[model samples]
Target: MKKIELGELLGQMTVSEKVGQLLQLAPMFYKGTITEGEITGPMAEMGITTEVSENAGSVLGSTTASEMIAIQEAYLKTNRLGIPLIFMADVVHGYKTIFPIPLAIGATWDVELAEKMAAISAKEATAAGLQVTFSPMVDLVRDPRWGRVMESTGEDPHLNSAMAASFVRGYQGNPDELAENHEKMAACVKHFAAYGAAEAGREYNTVDMSMRELYQNYLPAYTAALEAGSKLVMTAFNVVDGVPATGNEWLMRDVLRDELGFDGVLISDWGAVKEIINHGTAANSVEAADVALRAGVDIEMMTTCYLENLERLIADGALPVGLLDEAVMRILELKRDVGLFEDPYRGLKGDVDRQQDILSVEHREVAREIAADAMVLLKNDGDLLPLGATGRKMALVGPLATTQDVLGAWSWLGDMKDAVSIEDGMKAQFDQVDVAGAMDTENVTEAEIAEMVRVAQDADVIVLALGESANRSGEANSIATIRLPETQYPMIDAIRALGKPVVTVLFNGRPLDLHGLIEASDALVEAWFPGTEAGNAVADILSGRVNPNGKLPMSFPYTTGQIPVYYNHLRTGRPADAADAQEHYVSQYIDIPNQPLFDFGFGLSYTTFAYSNLELSSDTITKMDTLTISVTVKNTGTIAGKEIVALYVQDIVGKVSRPCKELKRFTKIDLAPGEAVVVTFNLTEEDLRYYKPNLDFTSDPGDFNVFIGTHLQAAFCLA
Candidate 1:
């Protein structure tokens, strides 16, 4: 479909039809067996008629194939131009064969695996009848209180950007999957413009940050997703800089469209167009429609505000007809681009695919590989991990011990029955396994603890599963505190007193305050909800099959008081290290240390790597120069392991104060024992850029401290 043809098609639409094109309704609007009264449920209250529902441009939250095909066939029968409705859903991690949550995917630090996961998700979702997925949430997060942290990659801009691009590439596919065969779904990069910066980590709270903060840190991932060919960008629900993002012209039009060069469809998050009135920026739904339309939002999702008020806005001259035409044309063009007009039943072969290939043996293998890589070793005192399951009997204890709740939140399409539990995974490898604990506290009584302790004491070792439930994280489930539930403490204390090898396999969505368990356990594995193959993946790490290689994308705090701790903090004027360690006037916490329990880019492997001879091609460089950095990493342990070599830059002098360290480049490489690899990073002038004092997005010339470390495992072999 050419631009003129799409525009002409838009021209043919009546004002009512054009308004209908801007609305995206849920499955309830189109499902056949639904009652008429129920069908008019919310839309009628919002002044939208059944006519608008029948003519809506898109549908979300649909899972069945026959029903979706029937809805489209029925709609096209009465439609004049015969346009196909694009189906979209929240295919966050996977469709049926769920992978680890986004946060766990971030822990893997494997761009290839991230892409693979997105590809599998797109394939499975398209097979089940979706044309798009609201995924690859690239929000950079620092606070763990936000439940949506599980949906995000992590706190670092560089890592999040890399992951975002990989996800877009995977979902949309290189050379375009829709162009190839319509097997892949269009990717929708979401919560645009610093949604993770919600005040005090509250969900739907206001986001207040400077333009420099926005451009420098928060906006990179969204731009990267756009640059990587995502077909849509979803507006955030919260207000940014005193204006709701769905109605902010500078945010949606100037920043997202003009600055980031996103020419794709811009859709509002669920009911966000209506919520603009609640933000006090719009007086009512009529004004909210006017505000959102003029702000460059192409679609109003799950709301009748646009359907009810767009024509009114145009008649009153509050909205330009060209804007509505443009929005409608974009929808038609996208539908055509995805080959929906060519075949409305594009990826609807999932029922057969499900029987043959959807979540087949090959997909499970990929999930297993990703799940293993996503597991991070937070602690391994005395090298107690990699303990074989056969030689010794192990007791698995915790709320998640035997439950199939391993798939974290946002996997609405996934079936929990298909998920493998920890007990199941442990029993496969270990000769004898004793399972305890419960997903809810109601089942975990004192009698349960006494019995579990008796069984656990007889075992040679204990594998304790711990962490937050799926409902505790993801979308509007933010928490004021991030400690493990107090109910589980009695069980933990009982297990600790057993004098057995106690290893904890944590299964939470966000980083938790691990001050108590840090000393209680022999080993701690941060397994943030590894999906479908969760049991086997952790079992692989517990056994010697796969060495731990994952790194933390975000820092783990010692306590909730140090909530926002990250590696790249700016240097304090009155630094704790600036004076004597015992000095009272220094900027130091009286009760706790001023460091994270675990730093960003921090991880442990079964083997060790030594970093030596960090060197630079030149001390400084001009605009025309490219500085080269090199560091030698040696595998010192007997077994082979993967090491993540990182390059951090510290600007010694700048017009604006800079972070103490910023991650520029990192690479994960596998090394055999006694083998060495010299990792090199080329730094061009663009790598040194930051938002200047005058807000110029250019690099300032100055001497810099080039820090190179092998996953921070080396204090420096400085020979």
Candidate 2:
């Protein structure tokens, strides 16, 4: 049936029947074990014609296919209306074959590989009885201190938008695939509004920003996801302009539904609808339901706010009956689109052959390939990498050298036993390698430091793996000081004193203050939690099988005081000049430099690449014209390597102040000895536009500067 025709049918249903569409309850069973009564009893009593089981609504931690199928079978057989439930899970990164975190994937700057990774994740999730994935979190997070930043694409809007579109396409492919096994699951582009720019980088904190900043800096990724055919959007936990996001009609209805033309179902984040009472925006559960339903939130996840109060709110004249009918129609249309109306068990099947595809060997290989590309080479002074295995005696030491902390953070449903440690990879490479455990499981000691020094005395090279534990940097894991633990610093200083060419491998979720380590080590690799295959991928780069082409997606700060530093920040009107700057007055600090430890797009290669003069197709253009900016890149060093040529643009005389440089385009190219290539980036008027005070997106014709290089200061131009 047509969607509008389905809306008319839902409008004829009673008020109690309309409230059933909003309720999503958890199931109480495992396999054939019946822990609680049938799902139909309570649902029938409340006049709920459409009810969702726990296994159908959202999967907690991890669940088996057999258990999920049993629950769905029971729901279908007992429910009066037989409205099939939609299954959802947090399949971020990977489902069973774990890959690197999202931030690490952004560092690779390879959209093709990221798209393939999501496709593999979708296949595995569908095999595990899931119809939806709450993934491709495209929020642009500038604060590394935020625990959820590890789940985002990175700090740039343009990069996030491109990656988001690729993920949506990969998850929901062409029409033929959608017909094959109900094709693919729905892709949920999450945190509907500004949830990343929280106060002090704290999770679920209040957000305060002008509308201009919201549209230009943060809203682009969500908009891109909608255009890519996303079926659902999850609301954030924070408030915008003193109104909670779960209850904000302007964001959910006016902006998303009216302005952007997004017709997807809006779901609350976890229990955000019930959380509005804690935000002091609602008096009780009934008021929370009244606010959320009016704001156009169609699904209430895990919270009983909607199930218990929506009917009362409608009867009391707080919520109109037409709104409830509209929400039920959208929900029913999604059910039919997924083919659940034809076959109730479309997503869940107990067939052993289908369950075997969840974590196949082919999926694991793709996980390893993506983890290797995500590794960013932070510093390599004197080209100290590509360790030779013929005659070198290497010493691998540190707390996390052989531990499971390499799995990174937000490894939901990921098995730690399958992860590879750095020590395992290094030992596999060479025959004469010595492994030494220098610290206790929980803390480091002085005796451990002495043992590390003694072990490195006879070795030709030292590989030190150091970073936080898995629990130290995730949610509720914020710290006042973002530095290496005091205990580990002694071990690092002791190993550096041995003078045996030290190479530091860092495993972290966010950027750390690495000033002391940079000065002590000959080389550094920022391997941000390369998931299941972390050890093997790091070994490949260390043994010269693959070159490190990954760049920093987030800035590495020199100190903790530069907590919120980024590359595209606006310049002040009276920027301090070094000649007249003093510690007492200007934006200068008394003790530290006002620069990052490593800038964005900063990474070293085994070989070097140089940029030549830039040429533009034309010097002047109108709003409808296009410009082609080209630059020549040549390999200057002996070793063959890959280089990421970046293009940045600046609007010099805008009505509002802009950033010093914004990344417009970038390309990664592989080069051989003495090889060169001409990289071209096309510019459109849309790339030059920014949101004004009134949310107008247009660029005024003026002199614009184009920058092309490996770093930000490579070349300059006027167009």
> What is the overall TM-score of model 1 with all chains considered together?
0.96
TM-score of each: 0.96, 0.93
lDDT of 2 by residue, 1-719 (tens): 45675666565666665666666554442124354446456555543433334223333323555665776676667555666666677788887678888888888888887888788887877777677778789878877777777778788888888788878777777522453454377788989788888888888888988888889888888998889888878899999888999999998899889988988778888889999999999999888988999999988876778778878877887778788877887777766666666665564543446656666778777887888788888877778888866688888888877776677676777788888888887778766677676444347888877777888899998888888776666665666677877788878888988888988888888888887788888998888888888888888888777788888888887787887888888877445554565536666566777778888888878888888867888777666777888888999888788888888887787878989889889888989979999888888888888877678987766767788743323322233
> What are the per-model numbers of colliding residue pairs?
0, 3
Q: What is the Å distance of residue 463 in model 2 from its true position?
A: 0.7
lDDT of model 2 at residue 629?
Answer: 82
Query: What clash pairs does model 1 have?
Result: none
The deviation in Å at residue 502 for candidate 1 is 0.6
| Residue 691 in candidate 2, Cα distance off native in Å | 1.5
Model 2: which ten-residue window has the lowest total lDDT? 52-61
Query: What does the lDDT come to for candidate 2?
Result: 0.77
Candidate 2 runs further than 4 Å off: 1-14, 27-34, 37-62, 175-183, 347-352, 438-442, 578-585, 710-719
Tell me, by TM-score, which candidate is best: 1
Error of 2 at 385 (Å): 0.4
